[model samples]
Target chain A: MRISFSTTLMVCLTFVTLGCNDDQASVSLPESAKPLAVDATPYLVTTEPADTTPVGEARESLMDGESATLIGTIGGSSKPFIEGLAAFTIVDQKIPCCAAEEGCPTPWDYCCTQDQVKDNIATIKIVDESGSPVTADARQLFGISELSQVIVSGTAKRDDQGNLTLAASTIYVKP
Target chain B: MLLPWEYGVRNLARRPIHSGLTLFALTTVTLLIFVVVGFIRGLERSLAVSGDPNVMLVYSLTSEENIENSSISAQIPDLLAASLSATVKHFGITHHSPELYLGSRVTTADQSPGLGLVRGVTPTAPLVRRTVRMTEGTWPQPGEVMVGRLAATKLGVPTEVLKIGNQIEMEGQAWQISGTFAAEGASFESEIWCDLSDLQTATKRQDLSLVAMLLKDRTASSEVDLFCMERKDLELRAVRESEYYQTLQQHYRPVRILGWLIVGLVATAGIFAGLNLMYGALAGRIRELAMLQVLGYKRVAILVSVVQEGLVLASAASLIAGTFAVCWINGLTVRFTMGAFALRIDSLAILSGCAVGLLLGILGALPPALKALHASVAINLKAV
Candidate 1:
């Protein structure tokens, strides 16, 4: 009986020792990949478009694959700039951006006017030759932040739900 | 020749105190397994059954994942009802419920204050939370409140404290408990519910926590999503209620894993205890076993008798433990951060406990039996 008990205890101790050693083994982690670089110089325009349309009106009127020159402020969601893609949502200038009126912390999100903000905001993506948005953060490419008014000349692509997306050929950053 | 099965039964009777001790040890271990497994099953079942796939929750994005922390404009429900009239309406009335959910200290007449989960809901709440049914009394009238079946357990008070017509106080106002409700054993059974507007008036809050709507079908989720997308001003995000609870279940995966580990450890200890008890019992019986071998019975026959003795004891232990768990432990209320749930010693817990008991008997007997049988009959008989 004593011998049997000793054998059982030794086996349990052996298992516990093995389990403890497994926890101490070192693990190697893989390196993170570098971010993709994109050039926005070709699409950058020094002069604003001659005929500009409000983002709200353009959202209502533009059909898919139609050309449009929409003017708007760089404000809608708190983070309007899309990460790893040269795309941003622009809200129509007609709706206030909450900076002056409400002293909202993330006035760029236009949260105070969120009810009507949807129709007034349109997504603008600077597409490359292959028609996919540039593989870089829009903030790094455009040097623009929330509440900056700009004009974008692009082809409007409307999804089935009538959400407007502007494939920009030119973007005029307001001084 | 084989020893009669009666020999094993007779051996157990010869050492009543020893056999009873082994039975007690085995029963205790099996009962512990039931308790741990019951906790895991109860917690999982509470979360799993809470979510309804066809129901959609619309809450402010600011609240992140917790719907209780979410606060949306009170008018949003009406706005949804008007904008998506076709989707929100079933027959003639709308199917949306704007609610106010929060945790607050509540006091019963006999009991001191205890933290309780409270929900301010309208009659429309039942339209979306379809599992809810009035177990007793009617829907809450103006100042009256309705209590969930598990509300008393959650509040750490006697069940009588929340009986229909009993008065409870919260938010600095005393309110009568007009009724009791059950949410099909869902987590909602731990909450105290009252009229939404009355709660708002008491709490002095104008905004609603979230709006839950019953969609026509699963595909109708997209329409609600589109509404949320278009009305960006609402800052509302829509999610399937089932998906939300599934995420909560995923969040609690670590706790369930810990429960399983505890069951494993306890069963391992029980097996070891069984081994020790069997070794002691067999040591004194070695001479008897060798005498049986001399009496024209094979060593395997004596070994089978030893195992049969252990099996009988373990099985009796399992039956006693299982009966005790079913009668006393099942549906025992357990309070948690998500409210309270009943410890479920359901079919699965009972089956697992029985499996452990049988495991203890077979595994514990085999090693010691083999060790005793290794000695020759001539050496064993001469010793005692």
Candidate 2:
């Protein structure tokens, strides 16, 4: 009787131990993300900007906060458009995206020209009054898609690495 | 008064065959639970431990979270090392490791070809993958390759075939086995590592899959993220190593759910079996139980004695099963899409098995015991 009682008691203790779970540690998403709202109609213009600099040349010449008009095709990566933001990558017209390459599934990614991509591409982000990138998807706002040619007039935001993000105030979607 | 515990013990001893069968059934059920629980724990641990909070992964954002399919410029690692030199280096050495990761057909001298996860890495890979330790021989030099401890299981080959000095064919090259390594039971243990340049030359691929960096501290993650965001032209995405594996864990939640469902179904079957055995045991003891109740023993006391008999059998069965699982199932290898991981029959698995056995005894015996007691004392005493 004592043996049975002891065995049952041990099993009960085991049950209690089994009920505990080891908590898994996880990293949280960044907290700096903020809401953005912008009206694309006010920023859209029918006239293309004059003396527009090529994306690659503008990248070399543009300084931080300098006003410039840049022209490029709407692609430099597979996912050119950022999710939940009015931003997309544009590559210099000279750099051939994979569109003409044989058996290239993601033509807009410029997979074949990856070596020159870093120097030839730039980001275009539409900004509102406070300068935050618009929260809406760029594809729907611009009424344009990948491979579309367009001109953007904005202040060039250059970081220490010389990578460019054009905070666009005007956009002309070529007919 | 309650029936003496000796009465339950003696009753079990009087019917040795029935009691032995019941014990066998319980052991089988409990052992199955141990195996399933061990599988889930092993997979979860493999992913969880694979991530280091201090390490970060830089890969092409276009790959859509598939690191193997990522293709980035070869110079990205050098660029990152130069850009984040302050927070990314330790002891005058930059902690960046450029790697080429992919799955390829592997062939050992004696075994048929099989698909294996392969990693092309530089010497600095050890800096970021801190959990890895070379267990035998030396690191891969030029034409040689290093295999992780579980590499054999991942490739569906025997352990003897992968020892040092053996040769394995992959990417149209036959490379000598240089050494074996373990990654503290991380998923990396299922991979085969070789020189980055050697793999690139053999496969005719100049691009790299990703770069892994060991940050000086958790705060340095922001610097890496800042680099990726600024250099959006490179189309790179930075993710914490731990967060990457956590995403993989979430991806495999369905498999874990399936594991729990199997446990539930198995436990249910065991309960039914227990119920059948208890019903049989009670049928033969109705008259004996009625006499006990008539002789000043309460119905509740007789019921308690029946439950005691079941609990004793369950406890013994759980003990035997737990020993067997720890001996055989522990560290047993299992293969999946990510790679192979061992079945970890740790303390939790053992306790879960014991709990299942206890449940079998309690849940299986109660219904019939209650039904027997519901009858009046007069009807039970009039039994043939």
Candidate 3:
């Protein structure tokens, strides 16, 4: 009886150990994978087409795989200013840490502040005259910031840079 | 002046083999019960101690998994942090730190891969979690990282390997390792920390995974929960750290129940064996019992003596079992799903186990004792 009772006890303990081992394995993740990101949205557009262009005229031209005029805002940059067109958002930014003696004046030393844009990069997004969205590669595009408004007349096509290319014939900032 | 129990002990010694077997059975059961209870209690205590009441985990309202699948916008963290600080201050809370969490990998200087919970924390995070202590090195600098001891060990790196001057890469960004900390016996011991902004940029995450706050009084946990939930602007849940662990205990309930069920079944088998052993002792000793009755001893005295013998056996078994469990099982550490904890083996668990053994002894001996007491004096004397 004593032996049987002990055997039963050992069996129960073994089960408990197995259960715990399984749970431990499940809670941990793999080493190579990145942790889950909290942000849900992966894409955003900041530009709008020029107001003077005939709305359907750009849409119809792009429907036949032809060039169309488009305009949009420029968002992010590593540097303070750029002369050409690009697509980006105007956000207040700061670096979290700085090398200055009194500390950097920015809210953060590593990144810029949020909701305010300090500089202009000429990154533009082209939209059809009907205001429907068009896909564009952001790296090759140039001048859209929260502060500067621009009008451009160009032939829009998908470029090798992965941005919707508008070969600009006329470009001017809205005053 | 001799006590009845002393006489009973003398009688128990006369039948060494029978008494020893009964004692052994009781001892085995007692030890099992004590060890099992201690294991459960110890794990519960460890869980409670590790969880901080001030911290709240926010998972997706839809799925109960980690926060990765949750889709709250990136801007919500700043907005919620401002609101929580104001609300918590009204209840005497002075600081709140919001953290974004992602699970990431770290490779030591030797290139051994280690898994870590990458937490994106503000500088104020240390203030909110006072239990987290820096064992060596300074706090995290922007673009720099800190790692836990367990993670360090897993990566086969020295604690100083990730110190302030070292640089490590993650998500294509080279971050300097600035500090090391230990949260002793907590899940945090398995994590890595970095500046909130750097982690966000590295992982391309803009939303906060959860927010944790420190309160003025520990007892006001419920109030804080209510306060957070009452706000229409922030849809959130509040649970005390203790209560959260209690809920987590649900995960182990099935195991606990299975343990008890097995114990109960084994105990029943032990009781039956004890009953048979007691019956055998009575049957074989009928001539001795009859002689005692013929020698002018009262039937009740004989019955009392028999019951006393059983109690003596049980008490001896209880002592042996208790001693063995304490020496062998107490403080034994076992790793479980959450983490590792030690077997506590407190006084109460030991006492309860002994009590069960004593009760089984009485139950097994009672029937035979009563039957011997009711035998006719004349018949017993004739048989003798």
TM-score (0 to 1) of chain B for each candidate: 0.96, 0.98, 0.68
Candidate 1 stretches with Cα past 4 Å from truth are A1-175, B85-88
Q: Write down the worst ten-residue block by lDDT for model 1 chain B.
A: B225-234
Scored by DockQ, the top model is 2
Report candidate 1's interface RMSD in Å: 11.0
Pairs with steric clashes in candidate 2: none
Model 3 clash count equals 48
**Model 2: residue B380 alpha-carbon error in angstroms:** 2.4
Best by TM-score: 2
- Docking model 2 quality class: incorrect
Candidate 1 docks at the CAPRI level of incorrect
> Residue B74 of candidate 2: its Cα lDDT?
100
Candidate 2 lDDT over residue span B1-384, tens digit each: 778879888988999999999999999999999999999999999999999988889999889888999999999988898888434676778888999999999999796798899999999999889999999999999999999999999988889999999999999999999999999999999999999999999899999999999888775675576567668668789888998998999999999999999999999999999999999888777788888878888878888988988998998989899999999999999888999999988777887788899899888888888888778888987866
Q: What are the per-residue Cα lDDT tens digits for candidate 3 across A1-175?
A: 9879989997886566445532222353321132332221222223444454432234333442455444433223232121111222222212122335655454221233322222211223333444322322222232233334445555554333222334444445545
Greater DockQ among 2 and 3 belongs to 2
Provide the TM-score for each candidate, comma-separated: 0.72, 0.77, 0.51
Task: Give the root-mean-square deviation of each candidate in angstroms.
Answer: 11.9, 7.9, 19.9
Any idea how many clashes model 2 has? Answer: 0
Model 2 lDDT per residue over A115-164, tens place: 88889888888777688666666677777888999899999999886789
Q: What TM-score results for chain B when candidate 2 is compared with the true chain B? A: 0.98
